[model samples]
Target: MTTPASSPSPSSSASATPPPGIPDPAAPPAVAGDRITQDRPVPLLRVCHFELVKVVSQWRTRLLLLACWIAPGLFVAAVSQQSTLPTDTLFGRWMLATGWAGPLVVLGFAGIWALPLLTSVVAGDVFAAEDRLGTWRHLLVAVRSPRRIFAAKALASLVVILLLVVGLAGSSTVGGLVAVGHRPLIGLDGHLLAPGDAAGRVLLAWLCVLAPTLALAATGLLGSVALGRSPMGLLLPALVALAMQLAQMLPLPVGVRLALPGYAFISWNGLFTGPAQVGPLLIGVVVGLVWATAATALAYALFLRRDFTNPTDGVPGRRAVTVGVLPLAALLAVMVVTVRTATGATGSGIDQEKVQRSVATAFAHLYRVQTGQLNRPDVTEAQLKATAACDKGGSTADPEGSGNDWRCVVSWHLPGVEAAGTALYQLDVTTDGRFVADGDGPKEVNGYFLVRTPTGDAPNPLWQFDGNVELLPATPKG
Candidate 1:
């Protein structure tokens, strides 16, 4: 039998014809679709848009976008009511940017249903949605390639997540500015922040705040693809986010904490402080990207390789997921160490006792007969409160390294100096081996320290009380 006429590529046109049973030489060749791109690489963005269109057109996606808008507005309003401080004040500003976007806000708003649910809803279903609806197999036939389709779907899901985050941040900021008023807020170290800095910080707080959440969404996408259940896609990511939160709170080592996305959540508190530290945040961003990418990759590999044997029950690769295990185990070890450290930290009040002894020892010299009159150490309530913060820090126990904070009330009996509430001198020594002296601090009518009554929880209007410093020691020869 004579073979069918062979077709030649356009590039091969003008070449001599082959003998019979070979492809035709003169006749225009049939179109080879694969060679269409032989001239140049197809733009990746084109593929990206193709996928984005698929995701955005879905009704659930539209509803998710709507929810992203409403969630932040309602949350900001509720916080505005409970807060006594004007949202513009130092504390209020802090609350608006970080405190609101933090885990506390997540807990209060998302409750049992975390926002990761929505992320999973989009990410998990972005691919499987097609398969679940029976459109995937048909589309695969048209695309003729599994890899390109996978990439497009993943990019589309990522774009959707980013859109959700941007929407939430924009709405929350506008809502917060309206609800709380734009005012300078305080830094984590109780320092004041300016209006410009506050605005910059609010933006950073929102942008950086959503990194881990997006990671959660990415992971949810993996679960969604594997399970093919629309609901499980949402729940799995939330559970994972919750687990990460627990890992962060377990008092793990700084290094281990650095790896956790949740640890990065509180980095926004540093915006107002003099020094900027986004170490944990950066780590979180890296780990988040890694986990998100890995999960999506593995899920795609499994889904693409497997047949439609069991739609409901996904078949995971036999290779176990040890990627998350190392960090998690390390985190758990660090947690145990941290608990031990904490328990041990409380008992060693050496620094605290040193403070008490220093005060007692220094003032004891003042009571000697040679001086004729006792010069008691003068400490204002403000000084005392500022110094004793470590002691009063939500408990009676001291923190690591004697809590790295110490203050004492230096008081002594004086013959002429009024004992009412005046301080002659003030010394402020911090536990980190530094001192804060307020020589220019307010003094009284009798040349003693003038104390200000701290307002609003003043912690007893206590300033900082430091041990006495001797200008001169009595000399026997003199």
Candidate 2:
């Protein structure tokens, strides 16, 4: 050391103790710039793929899918063995006679609760499972972004719902075709549809329900995120659906009823009629998409803001409460105001021109249907030459109010009768727009009863009286 510690060689000097803040020169010499390169966020498709794999691997999911695939066949078999057709539901009267009607029966049952329940099983559990398994931390760390994770989970749930719907529709179609032959189908308009056309319409009707089903899945996902991973998350959405359905059955205002989810579920009925109306179907699609978008946004925002490090933070806080309560309160206030307005305006009066036109159209259709049932090809709308004039309590001042004392004078000519006869109709109009009429006409027409002779003995033809009729609003003729 004294011998000039021989100014250390260049190599030895470079390897000597380094400055305190500087990195070691020989330790693979630190890179010139930032030592850690930031990795790009995981792709959404990859995340969704992972979620799909997770879902398909679970025994619960597999079991539910299996049930969905088999239940329709079992239902068709059981229904085929029954002696009576279920006539309460729309299109149910023909369920046992035609393959196309079978799907309608299944759809009617599914709309009650089965579809929602099936959708919720996976949607409610997708997000909650992470928290239940104490793996949120791991998932967050692995995915590195909560938004992407939520998107992946939601997409997976939607995919699962689609699969379920397809399975149900296909299975029902196959089972129905096997159990009941693909004969001509009777439409809502009382017209006959060929077998091929009937199959197409049935398939379209089944596809129309996809919108509402996706909305339900979104609702379940929101519940899972807000309520945490639990059974409540699974049950609350179904309860909400049930409550909505009940609300639809109430005497609510038209606006409010149209806004409910239950209305969307049955919108597919429009597809089965001639001159198909797409308005309700489009509205349903809009409502479903809005609900799904709003729920997805809320879930994503809440998940991003949530702090999983603190257990107490997992519960919905003031912001969540405010987010939920404000909209509900607003909706409730609107509903209350609408219902009150509708109830108080019962005496607002009706439009004479509208009622007159409606009555005329209704009478024509009623006459045609009645005569057709008796196999009377000679009795036609043109031959009857019907004309109706309606009055409310014999005054034109207020023609459109709820009353039991409305009257219509209808004039028509019977075949081979030279003179036109006038019939007096006593009408009772309800607030819900139904018409109950009792007619007093010539003794020959008033006392006559039409007997329909059935082509087959199994289902006896129904009989009709000539002078009484119940009619719905003119807007929906069927």
Candidate 3:
């Protein structure tokens, strides 16, 4: 009995003096309902995998992936079949005619709507579908916490977006290059767009197209987590975008267009053109980051607090879609009506004979002074003066306009050359009354038919002189 008192068996000793403050090994294991275990969910690859599986399980995401392929192909085909003129500048040179080739190839084919919307469909759905499908409860048990689940979902979503973007860029670029003739690209402003430099810029421009759309996608995520319908998030961001575009297009004060997502993303023009404007470009990028980050953060928080078990369960609402679409439809309708009103002028078609006569007269006078063909007319004194007088009263595309709706300021002074023929003409002569450059080299003649000097290579001293500056209208009008 004394011996037994000296040494209680191991089990008796353990039970009598509870294990020093540590959790007793003998206690029942924790489950979801248990307080300590309930509070903490251990991070695990299994959790990440579980969320990823859920994302891929949805069929809509797969359909979007399919769209990613089909859209660019259709665009390239349309560009090839429909286009008709070279844009003239190196960047846009062939864009007017060819959809795939040259610098404008990206713009002409991918265009304004397709790529942006394709990105939106996939990006907009990432987290939104989770709420749409009523699957947050299933997600909760697999992942330790909602935040971690949201993070995995977002990362997976981004990977999907990036994959789609890559598909779009590669397919479009190839399709455009193949379908439209790939000549050197010219810009809308007619700048020489080098091909090697331009290819990279265009690829980047396609990438930058992602800029404004990310916020749309991020906002979608927020709506998914908060509203249980991803579409709610889709509405406000698109509305913000729509409102900004309207404000920008308005004949407003400075900084107006800067607010719009579409306007901010307009810097892709610079990438295609010779001189890219980085101010708008950088602003858009920064703003895009802010928009995406804020929405994502909000989604994270909402998702964290959401009662996914019951869902904000109700019939999914479509007000946001109506809100998104109606304004845009109205805008398009207004634009169509306005365009018809402005263009449906009560007038006969343009008169070519009168225009030809005027252009011929101007050419004769200017060429005589520059070439000393008429021993320098007393009125056509200096370079500027001769160009001015010759360009004045030029015939226009309009049948009724007294002066040419568009004018020309033709000159050629190669950076190093000190010659009369080496001039680059700035022809501010479009039907729209906008400026358009004509020749980038030398002018063989003035405005009408005449041949002078050529550079680089030529047959003879006469026809070789072919750096003439002529502003062709939308249609070569009167």
C-alpha lDDT of all candidate models, in order? 0.49, 0.65, 0.47
TM-scores, all candidates, are: 0.58, 0.70, 0.57
Off by over 4 Å in 2: 1-37, 328-455, 458-478
Q: Candidate 1: misplaced stretches above 4 Å?
A: 1-47, 74-114, 308-398, 401-478
Whole-model lDDT, model 2: 0.65
Give the lowest summed-lDDT range of ten residues in model 1: 469-478
Each prediction's RMSD over C-alphas, in Å, is 13.2, 9.1, 13.7
lDDT (C-alpha) at residue 447 in model 3: 32
lDDT order, best first, reads 2, 1, 3
Name the best candidate (by lDDT). Answer: 2
Per-residue alpha-carbon lDDT of model 2 for 320-359, expressed as tens digits?
5565436544544654454334333222224455455545
- Minimum summed lDDT over a 10-residue window in model 2 is located at 461-470
* Candidate 2 residue 449 C-alpha distance from true site, Å: 15
Number of residue pairs clashing in candidate 2, backbone atoms closer than 3 angstroms, sequence gap of 3 or more or interchain: 2
User: lDDT per residue, candidate 3, 1-478, as tens digits?
Assistant: 3554466789887676644434345666566554555235747566667656655666866776676666665665565565343344223324433433432344433334444554455545666666666666656654547677777777766667677667667766766667764544533333335566657667677777676667666755655554456465445445555565555444432232333445435555544333354444555565566657666766675556555555444224453334334443454354334323433422211233323333333333334333443233333323322222124344533333223242333332223446633233333332211223333334344232233333322111111111111111223222
Superposed by TM-score, candidate 1 places the C-alpha of residue 285 at a distance from the truth, in angstroms, of 2.7
lDDT of 2 at 333: 62
